[model samples]
Target: MEKHGLRERKKQRTRHALIEAAVRLFEDQGYDQVTVAEIADAAEVSPRTFFLHFPAKEDVLLADADLRVDLALRAIAERDPAEPLAGVLVRAMDQMIAHAWDSDLPTGLAALRARLAASVPALQARLLQRYLTAQADLAQALLRAFPGRLDAITASALVGAMVGAVGAAALTALRRGDGPDEVRDAMRQATALVARSVT
Candidate 1:
C-alpha cells in the first residue's frame, strides 16, 4: 500500500510539473509558439512522458475542467436522493472550488488558460467541445441519481444552464482581470441564480 501510494504521488508530481511548465511557457512565449518538446524539457521530462499525461498541448489548459467534471459526477452520485437537483449542482460547484483551492496548481492557471483559449481559435473550439461533453456527462449522472424524477430533456437543460452560467461568469471575471477568488465568487453567484431559477 505504501509503495502504491508513493507511485501515485510521483505520478502526480510529474503531472503537476508538466502543467506548471506548460502554463509558464505558454504565458511567456504564447501558446502557439510553445512545442511539446519545449514543455517536456521545461518540466524535466521526455516528450513521451508528457504524452502519457496529456494527449496534446491544448489538453493542458483543459485538464482542470476535465477533472472537475469527474468530481461533479462523483458529487452527484454521493448526494442525498431527496435533495433538489439544483442544490446538488451547487454543492458540486462548491466542491470543485474547494478542490481547486486545495490543489497544488498555481492559483491563476485557470484564468490564464481561459485567456489563452479565448485568443486561440483551436483552443476555443476544444473548450466548447469539452463543455458539451461535460454537460452530457453531468446530465446523465443527474438522471441516474434522480431516477424517474427527470427526463433526458429536462436533465440536459438543467445541466446546460448550470454549465453555461458558470462558464460565462468565470469568463467575464477573467476578462475583467479579477483574481481567482473573484472569479470563483462570480461563478458562485451565477450558480446561485441558476439554482434559484430552477427551484
Candidate 2:
C-alpha cells in the first residue's frame, strides 16, 4: 500500500512538472513555437514520459479539466435532492472556482490557456469539443439528479446556458487584459446570473 501510494505521488509530481513546464514555455515563447520535446526537457523528463501522461501537446493545456468535470459531477451527485437544479449547478460552479484558485498551477495559467485557445485554431477546436462533452456530462448528471423534474432537453439547455455564460464572461475578461481575480469575478457574476434566471 505504501509503495502504491508513493508511485501515485511520483506520477502526480511528474504530471504537475510537465504541465508547469508547458505553461511556462507556452506563455514565454507562444504555444505554437513550443515543441513537446522542449516541454519534456524543461520538466527534466524524456519525451516518451511526456507522451505517457498526455497524448499530445494540446492535451497538456486541458490536463486539469477532466478532474474539474469530475468534481462538478460529484457535486451534483452529492447535492440535496430537494434543492433546485439551479442551486445544485451554482454549488458545482462554486466548487470549481474554489478548485481553480487552489490548483498548484502558476497564477494566470487559466487566462493564458484561454488566450492560447483564442489564437490557436487547433486548440480552439479542441476546446470547443471538450466544452460540448462537458455540457453533455453536466446535463446528464442534472437529469439523473432531478429525474422527472427535468427532461433531457431542459437539462441540456440549462447546462448550455450556464457554460456559455461563464465561458463568455471569462473570455471577455481575458481579452480585456483583466487579472485572474477579475476573470474569476466575471465567472462568479455569470454563474449568479444563470442561477437567477433558472430559479
Candidate 3:
C-alpha cells in the first residue's frame, strides 16, 4: 500500500508538471503552434508521459472543467436528502459556479477556449462531450441518491437540463462581456432557472 501510494503520488506530480508545461508553452506560443514533443521537453518528461496525463492537447487547457464532474456528484450527495433532486442540483451548481469564480482562471484560458472552438472542430466536439459525460455522471448520482424512485430517462433529462442551463448562462455572460460580477450574475440566473423547475 505504501508503494502504491508513492507510485500514485509520483504519477500525479509528473502529470501536473506536464500540464503546467503545456499551459506555459501554449500561452507563450499559442496552442496550435505548440506540439506534444515540445510540451514533453518543456516538462522534462517523455512524450509518452504527456499522453498519459492528457488524451489530447486541448484537454490540457480544459482538465479543470472535467474534474468538476466528480465534484458535482459529491456536492449532490452532500445535500439534504429531504430536498428534491432539482434543489440538490441547484445547490451543487451553486457550489460549482462559486468554485469556478474563485479559481481565477487566467484570462487566456477563456481566450484560448474561444480560439480553439473557432479553429478546431474537434475541440468543440470534445467540449460538448465533456458536458454530456457530466450529465450522465450527475444522472447516475441522482439515481443512486433516490434509489428506485427515479427512472433513468427522467434523471438524465433533469441532469441534462441543469447542465445545459449552467452552460447557457456561462456562454451568455461570456458573450456579453468579461467580469466576475457578470459571471456571478449569470450563475445566479442559471441556478434560479434550475430552482424554479424543482418539485
Candidate 4:
C-alpha cells in the first residue's frame, strides 16, 4: 500500500509538472506555436514522459475535469434524501463550482480556455465529450440516489436539464470575454435554473 501510494504521488507530480510546463509555453509563445516536445523540455521530462502524462495538449487543459463528476456525486450523497433533486443539484453545482474557483478565480481557467479555444480543435471535441460524460455520471448518481423509484428516462431528463443550464451559462461567460465575476454570475444563474427546473 505504501509503495502504491508513493507511485501515485510520483505520477501526480509528473502530471502536474507537465501541465505547468504546457501552460507556461502556451502563455509565452501561444498554444499554436508550442509543441509537446517543447513542453516536455520545459518540464525536464522526455517526450515519451509527456505522452505518458497527457495524450495531447488538450488533455492538460482538462486534467481535472473528471474530478468534478466525482465531487458532484459526493456532494449529492451528503444531501438529505428528502430534499428535492433540484435542491441536491443546486447544492452539488455550488460545491463543484467552489471547488474549481481557486483564489485565482476565473482568470486561470479563462486564460487556459482561451488558448485552447484558439489553438486546438481536439480540445473543443474533448470538452464536448467531457460534458456528456459528466451528464451521464450525474444521471447514474441520481438513479442510485432514488433507488428504483425514478425511472432511467426521468433521471436522464433531469440530468440533461441541469447539464444544459450549466453548459449554456458557461458558454455565455466564455462569450462575454471578461473576468471571473461574470463567469461566477453565469454559473450561479445556471445552478439556480437547475434548482428551479428540478423542483
- For model 4, residues 1-199, the per-residue Cα lDDT tens digits are 9999999999988987887787778878977788889999999999999999777877777777777778898987777868877788887787767766652244365557745765578778888888888888888888888887678899889878877877678667766674677776788888886677564
Check candidate 4 and list the clashing pairs.
none
Clashing pairs in 3: none
| Per-candidate local distance difference test | 0.84, 0.87, 0.76, 0.77
lDDT of 3: 0.76
TM-score of each: 0.93, 0.93, 0.78, 0.82
Candidate 4, residue 124: how far the Cα is off, in Å: 1.8
Off by more than 4 A, model 2: 104-106
Q: For model 4, what is the error of residue 46's alpha carbon versus the real structure, in angstroms, after optimal superposition?
A: 2.3
Runs off by more than 4 Å, candidate 3: 1-17, 104-107
User: Model 3, range 40-155, lDDT digits (tens) per residue?
Assistant: 99989988988888888878767677657667888878778688776787777877777667542333455456556766777788887887787888898888888888889988
Summed backbone clashes in each candidate are 0, 0, 0, 0
Judge candidate 4 at residue 108 and give its lDDT. Answer: 68
Better of 2 and 4 by TM-score: 2
Models sorted by lDDT, best on top: 2, 1, 4, 3
Q: Give candidate 2's whole-model lDDT.
A: 0.87
